[model samples]
Target chain A: MRLKTRPSHREKQLSEDKNFLHRFGYAQELLRDMGGFSNFAISFSIISILTGAVSLYGHGLTYGGTGMMGFGWPLVALFCMMVAASMAELASAIPTAGALYHWASLLGNKRWGWYTAWINLIGQIGIVAGIDYSVAFFADGLLSPVLGYRMTETTTLIIFALVLVSHGVLNHVGIRIVARLNDFSAWYHLGVVLILVVSLAGFGKGELQPVDSLFRLGETFSDKPYWLAFLIGLLQAQWTFTGYDASAHTIEETIHPRVRAPWGIFSSVAFSFVAGMIMLAFVTLSIQDVHAAVSADNPFIFVISQALGSTFGQVVLWMIVLAMWFCGLSSVTSFSRMMYAFARDRGMPRSDWFARINKHYRTPVAAIWLAVILSFILALTDYFIKLVNPDTTYTTLAFLTGVSVVGLYVSYGIPIWLRLIAESKGRFTPRHLGPWNLGKWGRTVAILALLWIAIISVVMVIPPNQNAGIALIMMMIVLLIMDLTYYRHHFPGPEAALQVSPEELARREAEFHD
Target chain B: MTMLGVLLILAACAVALAIGIIANRNVRAFNEETHESFLGDRKERDAFEDPSVS
Candidate 1:
């Protein structure tokens, strides 16, 4: 007879983790190997400070000038940490995949989950679309001499498809590979940023901007009020601060999730908040001529080339492109995970198709493609729009950013709001509170977070992004219609998973093992 | 001054987060205790409802 042996501490911990998840009515499907750092890395990689900061640097300069660049960023960062802290508490209480959806379903209602899941997914898809398209745009502009042609709409679509396809394939393989890359990406962002900041200070031959100009209290462009433009400039940092929820959304695959995942959420934002400020400050200070840099077609590139030679700048740009690629890769991973979790509860239109996990790969093959294809379609919106209305300034680029930033903030707000309401009513008892809780500070943070979301959502949709504003209103009407006609009858919501008995739950999990 | 204010707020948040980490380190044990309490209460209720307990 084989001797009975005690389970190792790691094995015991895994069992406890699985049981904790089972209470929330989920099977341990995704491999649970991600530690605190790995959990933090996924969110950090998705945040991709280099990608957002560099991509939107010109927008900041044109709209808000030095004051906005200096003041607006950290202000946005401060509010974003409040948002992260609020989210972290919820992430701790119920550390599930597609965390926002689960939190809403339990705290509020199924309809809330449905809307939150859809909006969050839309935001993520928009992010993936925007990130990859920026890569193609930069590659065409910066490397055109070597590549031999500028990117037309047709060529741009081709490049966009290629980039999305690569991310899809990488994600389809498995989370292990994706997590490893995300870990490397986190370090890469910090290291490259350190290099870039130092390079700008040490290698620049150009005259620096005035020291006092950093706090100059006015806008460079006055087409709009200084305050309005400054708020609009907040998009540059607001966009970067997003996707830190990737940590929450991947908690099922993380160990000791209640504590680790919350840490992941806050740490990712806090790090990006600091690192991004340093990077932008260096770039702003290195500007030889404000007019020349701001008026140039691509201010970020112009600033780099002016500070260092074009050859050296090109090297830096290539590194940034690679960072964007990693950003897209990590994004698709989070997108598919959320899609899979939502579909698992029959929340999506074709739930079963998207919810399937490849037995061998243990990854959602169909959902990965769903994210790729949806984002690709959104990416092409600009191409068709420009072809139809050549004079229009309303491109889908702003639409994508608006949807991504505003839609995500809205999705994030629903759960926070619901939790606040539950607490105010005294319905949310201590058992409902998570281990890594904000306690008395929770309500205060949630209120601030919602107020910030409301402010930014309005700012994101006005003026140049009016089309996005219209689109969002249309989306709400469509969702309400769908809920009444289709989902009301057909969809079971999260109860499909949540109502399962203990015996049934074990049987379903066993099927995976076999 | 704005920079200083922002940095100050960020630092306060960071310190609070660090405190949360140390405070919540024993979630696994807390979860176990909660589960045991729940099961123990259920068993007591079951025993109380037994017909022979009269």
Candidate 2:
């Protein structure tokens, strides 16, 4: 008789993972160089606390005062953790590059999945544009003294384009390099944020705000009700918590994804929550004059420069600028992977080209460039809007960011809600639970996540002014029309286009069940 | 800080700790279950494919 030697543990795990990919009708295309830490790094890097917490601190302070930074952050973080937990369950279940799109389709239906994919794609593009532009804005301020000239909007736009292109080039190089940069990015964000917080706590020259002042209700800088202003202030936390889906989107490139990807999603949010709150507290306490800080453009920058002096503050700001650039780069990586996966399932026009992997670099070059180009277009559109009507500039950009955040959260909520329904109805039950499973807590977390998304979706659209609300409604109408006319007929969804033969799927399923 | 601020900070820590513990437990349990199930499945498949292996 022939002897059969058993495969080693690592070999067995790789084989099963590859078989799992085969069941989805995809070969192992992307290089799987990412371990658990690298998997976590991508999401952590994309959700760079330096980018959103510092950039948008003024917005929160304007509407909700220091109370938002002190009290509102943890509250928002708790809710976000719930959402992240729900997403982790789904990530473990599907563990594909399509991520949310694949989960929605498998749990719900093709139409739902198509809408989810489009919304997520739009959100990814918007996020890339927003993050890169924000970086450009900061870089402009940082370089103005060195350049001896105030940077204009056109100059910033040029810088934004260059940043976007550079991110695209780096992503095209390979996943290995991207993973290394993201690993570096995770530590850099934590180290720099810690340094800044410590500096503000110890050496800040301004008189610190009293502890009670941190939680006391203050002015909203608006005529709206206090509660409404507080909700608006929550945007700082909401926006920062986004793009953690980066981990899920990179599942195909991650090792032992069924376990690692879920943990990646959960731990990124958990760490960000703790670290973000500490940073927020320190920055809020360092603000000497609330009115003066709020009145100044880029209040966080103003506070930093004032507290630390221009030279030291600029040096610190350079660190943030680098982190933001890394944030934008990681965003592109996530965006391109989503685009490639969606296209691979024939969800977009010219699906074959966008889905093509570069043999030389083992990266999706076409998808990366497409995302880069679309983001550039979005940024250019924002620039033109400002040039044409400066009065509506803030409102327009706010509307875009609003749409981005709403779209992504809505997409996230849909699958979680559907999963909840599926589980309750006994329609779907995961045979192999991922390491991040909430178990009995899953239902409670999913329900709360859905509710939170529903509330935030409304808050996002109605912000800044009524024009934003109107624009949001118009955009929804456009999406619906496009869905009915084109996508409904052409899109095959993830499973329809990517699933293997029934017998093979059954065998794989049976093996897992065993 | 106000009582509310202190409470908020304490609550944040509490929530973080609770979730961290839950996550750690889940990871450990999941690893054990997955490893055991995978080995069982492989043995069953091997036995079925080759009678002599049994």
Candidate 3:
């Protein structure tokens, strides 16, 4: 008899990943160009420190003073790490695109998965909109001096659309290019943030704040109690820590995903937490005058410009804008993957088109365009609202950001809670426990994640001002209506539709190789 | 520096150090275990991949 040769490590890994995909009735449609580092890079790029920390610094300072930066950031980061750890465990167990939906389906039922998928889809789109709009704000700032005028709402909208389209085009190219960009983005964020911090510390012209000021709980922009203001200030950290799910959502394109995906999710949050805290300390300490900084439209820009000369500050701002653009681009990649996966399992409308991978590029081109177009529409709506009612006091960014956080965190919590219940009852045995299993610590972390998400969900919906709760209610109403109508009759959930019997999966795998 | 500022700095250091150590240890353990397990499974995989097998 002829001797059979053993497959190499790389081949075994690829074969195992392919078999996992076959179990879900997929045929390795997307190119698997991402390694562990690239997987981590995607999540880190999405959680770009330059994007959230810079955009929302003034908001945090206004609500909770410098103490928010000093204390609240680490506190929120700790809770977010807990949430990420729990989700990482689940991601390792499933290792699929649209990870949250698949986890919910396997852990709970199809109905649960359907709702989670929709919520995750909405959240991803919102992230694209929010990140791009922030990019437009910075881009306009960068161009205004050269253009000899500040950007009007219309001009800003144009910039936003252009950025969105550029991101969509880049995503359409292929996963390889996207992974490369994300890898570059990760380094850019780390290097730029460190450079900015060091520059501010070394060459800052302004007198540093008294050390107590960093920890002093001072006045708020809102009339609420000090505790509530502090709680509200936590939004900056919470938002910054999001989109780590991008790692899980792109698990299908990752090598050694069972081990790598979980580490990607965990490490992204861990690294961001440390880097963000250090950056916050440098920026907050370098603030010359708290009142002047907070009063300016962009406090971060104000602080940098005042301390480090306008030219250097502008250069830093340009770097941040580039980082945010990369952030939005990576978000599109992640959002399109989730949309394609959902569509492939017949969970979306026009499934046939959205599920189609470009033969040449090997990408979900249609889904990428759809995500960007929706983001563009949302950005346009925000611009139009500002133009028509400049004095009406509507907070478009706040509402959109709230919807995004609440939806994403709730979707994250559902599967975690279900997994906790199943584990406690001794019914949740994973078919293949990935390398990063939490073992005994899993249950405790899951409980804490659920609690943290619950608190943030309530905080997200209860707006600080009048007319702020409308978005949350609207999202609920839409979900309710869907549950009552279309989804009730037609949705069989991801498990029923995607899972294949062992024999059928074997047959399909053989055919796929052929 | 104020006590709070010192405290904040110390806390940041502690968090960074603790998480760094944990992540490093876990990653090392994973690599070692995976290497051993893959070596142990080579024969079984060879048998499984054989076309003449079941």
- Give the docking tier of candidate 2: incorrect
Ranking by TM-score: 1, 2, 3
Estimated TM-score for each candidate: 0.91, 0.90, 0.89
Question: For candidate 3, lDDT tens digit of each residue in A430-513?
Answer: 333455666556677688889999998887666462333465567668887977777666765555545457676565334433
User: A10-96, model 1: which lDDT tens digit per residue?
Assistant: 677778788988876678877777878889999998888887777777777777887766787777877888888889988888788
| Candidate 1 overall lDDT versus native | 0.78
Give the lDDT of residue A51 in candidate 1.
Answer: 73
lDDT of each: 0.78, 0.78, 0.76
Query: Cα deviation in Å at residue A467, candidate 1?
Result: 1.4
- RMSD in angstroms, all models? 6.6, 8.1, 7.6
Model 3 complex DockQ against the native: 0.08
Worst 10 residues of 2 chain A by lDDT: A1-10
Chain B TM-score for the candidates in order: 0.46, 0.53, 0.53
DockQ of each: 0.07, 0.16, 0.08
Off by over 4 Å in 2: A1-11, A393-397, A430-432, A465-472, A497-514, B31-54
Cα lDDT of model 1 by residue, B1-54, tens digit: 556645654674575466455435534334533421011111111212333211
Which parts of model 3 are misplaced by more than 4 Å?
A: A1-8, A430-432, A465-468, A497-514, B1-54
